[model samples]
Target: MAFTVSANFAISADGKISSDPQRPSGWTSSQDHKRLLELRRNADAIIVGRGTLCADNMSLTVPDQTPQPLRCVVSRKGNFNGNEKIFHSHGGDIHLLVTNAISCDFERDSVTLHFANLTDFIETLHRDHGVKHIHCEGGGMLLRALLDYDLLDTLHLTWAAHTLFGGTNAPTISGLDDGIFFSSRHFSLVEMIESGAEGELFLTYQRNDAAK
Candidate 1:
């Protein structure tokens, strides 16, 4: 069985993913947020990096919905607070994927912490958990790791016209690469969505079957 991995992110026209360290305000437009929620609603499981979870303090739950999809967080250090809104609330199932070096003594039926390599973690999510569709909402580090591993099958990107917070430390959706050669095939444009007053381009790309 083949599992599909799709990445979704909003970046400025200048290709900056986030403007601030604490909050990502103005990076993603209001219309993009609505579309993201709809994508979340359609996904079987939504995956995020630990940095994004801690920075945003997200609960990762859909409001007024029952039997929500599992919330998965990929963390090598497993340093997140258990008392955070995501773990404390009993809305949906929560799964934490951590390296074997991390240890946790927390006990809760609603939450399950698993230790495995990142590649094994992805395989388990697909083969054991019955996850057909995986959506990645990321911090740049995570995106880089996935792309490096060639785990991404598709990408959904929204480019906004606003530009904010640029420096050596700020991260972009596509991280540092030494111009490594990789084959690229043409992908059809899905939609050119405008976010309210400002026009933001929503683009989707699918990997070529022959390339894989």
Candidate 2:
């Protein structure tokens, strides 16, 4: 509960993470990709929803770094694809948090599965694994859940203005188009950098303690 959680995302000018819901977010510049790796390097663990993991074919490994961050994947029923790139990649321990009672028998030496709610799983990561900082690379709904739980501590965003994903159903940063509402979570901008050449903007925000 005391650990820090930071979420990273790259959104188009229209506030969409991807042109298509299932498409990988590879539209950002190489500079943004480097920034993503840098963020991963600083985390004790990396978390992603099953959807994002599959969509992007993410390996969740920090390149050339010893003792990579723990790779964590969460799903409602633990229906993860064992064939996904993350499973075969070299990285720290893999933790699968299943929120439902549905059994996940993903057998592997590096993989450890847990059936628990998100809050409890996070607490276990902190209390048992000594995870002090968690970096989340998301596909929207997962980020929304973290916000609803008041667990997000920091936000890193790359605003890619060059691409446009114009559609009424396009998902925003929170993917909250279902009319379900949560209280406003306030964050203060801590850093901002303009990359005019790349047509992108990098921003970092810290959750406002007063709001909590």
Candidate 3:
């Protein structure tokens, strides 16, 4: 089985995913809030980087929705705090993907840990869990790794012009290193919707091959 990844994010006009000084995505318009829930509704699983999990403290729950998608977290070092809401959520499965380069001493009945490469990790989602469509909410680094490897298939972006989080170190949807580039991993616009009169945009992008 082949699994496709779609990333969702709301960003400031400055192209920062979140505030440079550390702020969650709650600063966006209410339209984006609805968009996010709708995105989650369509996904078979929702994935986030460990940085995002810690920074945002996401609830990872879908209300009034049957068969909630799996809540997945990825970490290079496998560092985590068990107090996260995802761990204690009432329904759905919690999964953690840890890389082979690090050691993760943490374990819990609520969380299933996968120690594998990125490719294998994704394959297991489709083969073992039957996750056909994956929604990724990122902290830049994880998304960067996916995009750099041509693993990302789509992007759902919300551009909020009213906000600005200024800092050179601030991250965007992708947090690639200074010299890395994936020229072939291009995305074409699948849809664009203007959100009222707030100078906000809801844009959808699919890979050049997948846009059809």
Number of the top lDDT candidate:
2
- The predicted structure with the larger TM-score, 1 or 2, is 2
Candidate 1 weakest ten by summed lDDT: 176-185
- Give the lDDT of residue 76 in candidate 1: 85
lDDT of 1 by residue, 112-163 (tens): 8888876778888888888888788887767766776677777788877665
Residues 9-73, candidate 2, lDDT per residue (tens digit)? 99887889886668787739987998999999999999999888998998899999998899999
Between candidates 1 and 3, the one scoring higher on lDDT is 3
Model 1, total clashes: 0
Q: Candidate 2 has what TM-score?
A: 0.94
- lDDT values, one for every candidate: 0.72, 0.86, 0.81
How displaced is residue 199 in candidate 2, in Å? 1.1
Question: Residue-wise lDDT of candidate 3 within 37-151, one digit each (tens)?
Answer: 8899988999888878877878777889989999988888787768876776675788899985555788899788998877788889889889999889887888887776688
Structural similarity to truth (TM-score) of each candidate: 0.85, 0.94, 0.91
**Candidates sorted on TM-score, descending:** 2, 3, 1
